[model samples]
Target: MRKPLQHIWALPVLAAGLAVPATAPAQSIDVTLVNGHPSIFLWVKHLTETFIPAVNTALEGTDYAINWSEAYGGSLAAVGGELEAVEVGLAEVAAIPTVFMPTQLPLQNVSYNTPFGPSDPRLVMESVAMLHDTVPGVEESWHEYDAEYLGGGFALDNYVLMTNFPVTSIEDLEGRRIAAPGPAVNWLEGTGAVGVSGNLTTYYNDIQTGVFDGVIVFPTAAAPARLHEVAPYVTITDFGAQYAGTLVANRTWFADQPEAVQNALRDAAAAYTEAYLVEQTDRVAAAMATIASDDDHLHVLAPEERTRWASALPDIAGVWAENANGMGLPGSEVLTAYIDALKAAGADLGRDWSQR
Candidate 1:
């Protein structure tokens, strides 16, 4: 559990007026927070509830304040357009999905391709931190875009399969119209599944109207949309977590912040990440249970069937690296560093794509 906001508030206030006040004068920095996801998604919920409040806790005594302007559901920036929005100063802070901007930030997508590498969210989070620390130009990837990478939010985990029709095996998925989010379509390639591009906002309607047999979505979005009611077959492919989402601020604005405010923002980002991770884990279970209780609709793929699907999917790592290289980024090197870190953390060879 997180410490109360009141407790966090007391730190700066207690030191004020002292001979050498416990902390320096509080510094405040104003930033406009933005996101491409809808208001109902877990990522958005985390942004509003856990993130905003946590930052406020960090700034308890600081004069630096976050001017939170939530331009959600792509109101400020369309899906796959956050990079331009930040680079052009339309937004001061953004929670951009690295997958959405693969060409611009290829290094971050390494995790998305390495499926089933690790299920522990804590280890996964640490792997990302380690990769950023060890990889060259990794942090600098953001500099060119005029944004500073604050940190990563929770990995929503490899997507689960939610279908209006039950799909129990790779054979079952053949020729079915599947709704996949951007870049994720690569995973469905060669599965004989017909892929359609769609975002979470349109998922419920699409499924209800039979636009798709099912969609690959995170539990966070599925539960809120009551997708379980429509397409209850939740198949946990566990394809590994995508680099998921990022919490970042405009580099120009971040650079001008007082040290205290910067520290506060950092602290808040970490707090928000941890809390959101826990929340997502809970949502997965709750969503699963709800669908299961509905009986006829909900189904989980058997273990052997899951293995078959995993085997059939393309080796996304090679595709990702090649794509990044084509974009003139250090695609192969960053991928190497990510794989090495996961192995060092005790990841098994079968799940390590670097060696492959």
Candidate 2:
């Protein structure tokens, strides 16, 4: 739980008569926060509830303060356009989805390319932050677009399959169309299933209308969307938690801010990421429990089958790295470092993607 805010009046009553003429009005800094997703989404929700409030709290009783203007739900930027919005100064800060901007943020999608890594969102986020701090090209990727890379990001929970049919094994998916977002379409490459691109907004309808037999989605979203009512057969695919996006500040705006204001924004963003992970973990457990109650409708893929499915896929990670290398990015280095970090953290990886 987040700490409650402290009242401004609680500050000490004027340094024991060491007063100047009068209390100077606190500095008002106007900031615009952006995200393409609606506020109902955890990442954007936290930006409003946690991040913005945290920034306010940090500056309470101080000379610096924030006046936040929020734009979400594609008001200022649509999905996959957040980077552009922030780059062009349409917004001062934004939560940009790395998966959506593959060409611009190639190194940021290392986790998506190397699937079946770890289900722990915290581990993945921290690993990525470490890379941002230590790796050469990680931060540079953001600077190229006039945005500064914040240390943490929104990490999605483990992906599950909600389908119209039961998937006891990977072979059961032959001729089926499974909807996945962004690079996740690659996850279905060798499973004999056709992977169509889709997202949460259209998932329930698409499956219900037979547009796709199933959707590869996380439980946190599945439960609230009541996806089971439409696609009742739930398969815990455990494709692994993914680092979806990060909150970025416009580089010029951030550089021009006072050090104190900059620190407050950075701290608040970090807090937002931490709070989001805790909320997501609990929501995931509850969602899985709710869907699991209907035993007849739920199936946890067999371990051997999970491994078989993983081993069957083409070297998507290697290809991603090769593509990155072609762009003169340290593709192989980031891949090797990420896989090594996951191994050190004892991730039960179904496939070691960095070997290539």
Candidate 3:
């Protein structure tokens, strides 16, 4: 088993008011951690490196500490199984990518279709926080599923393409298999490209074994997976950097935690949010450098080709909203509010799906 990533030799003491109540003697608080993706994804790395260390630091003086067992590589929960895992108490804490469960977590799917908007991690995070705060009873969706969202957000660099062959125009992608998760596939519909179902773990082998021609994933993911070796063509789409993953714990497990442990978890969430963004932002530049000089064919998709993509995709917004509505989540309102917020933040409404 590989050790998780961590930074910081020491952490600052918390303010008096922020401290959790230390109650009872000889009580130990344990949290079982589950990650959906393999340990290779940047998001998982963030959980291990930045998030867990911060949680450990915050819980140093407390009787509560994470047992910190990783159920990675699908040993515990398979891909797209995280939400159910947490709900059933298979894991006390889990990082569930909402895009993976669009049918189950409709409320969380707001960010996936609200794309071509913000690529900045900071902006995405703030927007998500605002949605949780402003949207009516958005937090209750978790409870309905028997889970309590502790805290979760993704800080991803801009998304790009890693292909086995060079693609400078939209025509190059015609009929080519591009591995993408849920709503991401909707972006390719009507474009003559076939979207395959695959995650980061399956990507490397898929590319190497010719299972896919390329993958529509973030640069942060491409680098660590070493996809550059097999798929040499790197296209910078900058279409959007998705921010959708969130942490949820079994409500029963969370309620059983001592106040000190709860506080430690909260502090860890804050630290993870800050550090995750910083590392992800930095990875963009680092990945570019590595790709450019390292025998990878990097191509910046031209403006016209991007326009073709923006034009060819179906009206995913309305479809998504309707899907959520079917699931009894606040689909329509969440969609409208999220779009309005993005527009207020100065996002250009490139493709008018409202009319469609």
Backbone clashes in candidate 1 total: 6
CA error at residue 34 for candidate 1, angstroms: 0.6
Task: List residue ranges in candidate 1 displaced over 4 A.
Answer: 1-29, 294-296, 346-351
lDDT of candidate 3 over 98-215, digit per residue (tens): 8787777777767667555566767767777677778876778888778887775674666777788888777888989999877777777787789887778788899888889988
Please report, in order, the local distance difference test score of every candidate based on alpha carbons. 0.74, 0.87, 0.75
Any runs in candidate 3 off by more than 4 Å, and if so which? 1-26, 62-66, 294-296, 352-356
Q: On residues 1-356, what C-alpha lDDT tens digit does candidate 1 reach at each position?
A: 99999999988777665656455654444567788778777777888888888878777765666666778887988777777788888887778877666567778767767665665666677777667777677778889989888875667654678887776667777899998776677668778899887877788888888888989876656777888878877776665555676788789887987787767667778887888778777776776676555656555666666566666667788778877777777788878877877777786433456755
TM-scores of the candidates are 0.84, 0.92, 0.86
Residue 5's C-alpha lDDT in candidate 1? 98
lDDT, candidate 2, 162-264, per-residue tens: 8898888988999999999899999999899999988777888998888999999888877877788888888987799999999889999999988888888
Using lDDT, give the best candidate's number.
2
Can you rank all candidates by lDDT, best first? Answer: 2, 3, 1
| lDDT for residue 232 in candidate 2, whole number 0-100 | 85
Q: Which residue window of length 10 is worst by lDDT in model 3?
A: 4-13
The TM-score that candidate 1 achieves is 0.84
Q: What is the lDDT of residue 25 in candidate 2?
A: 92
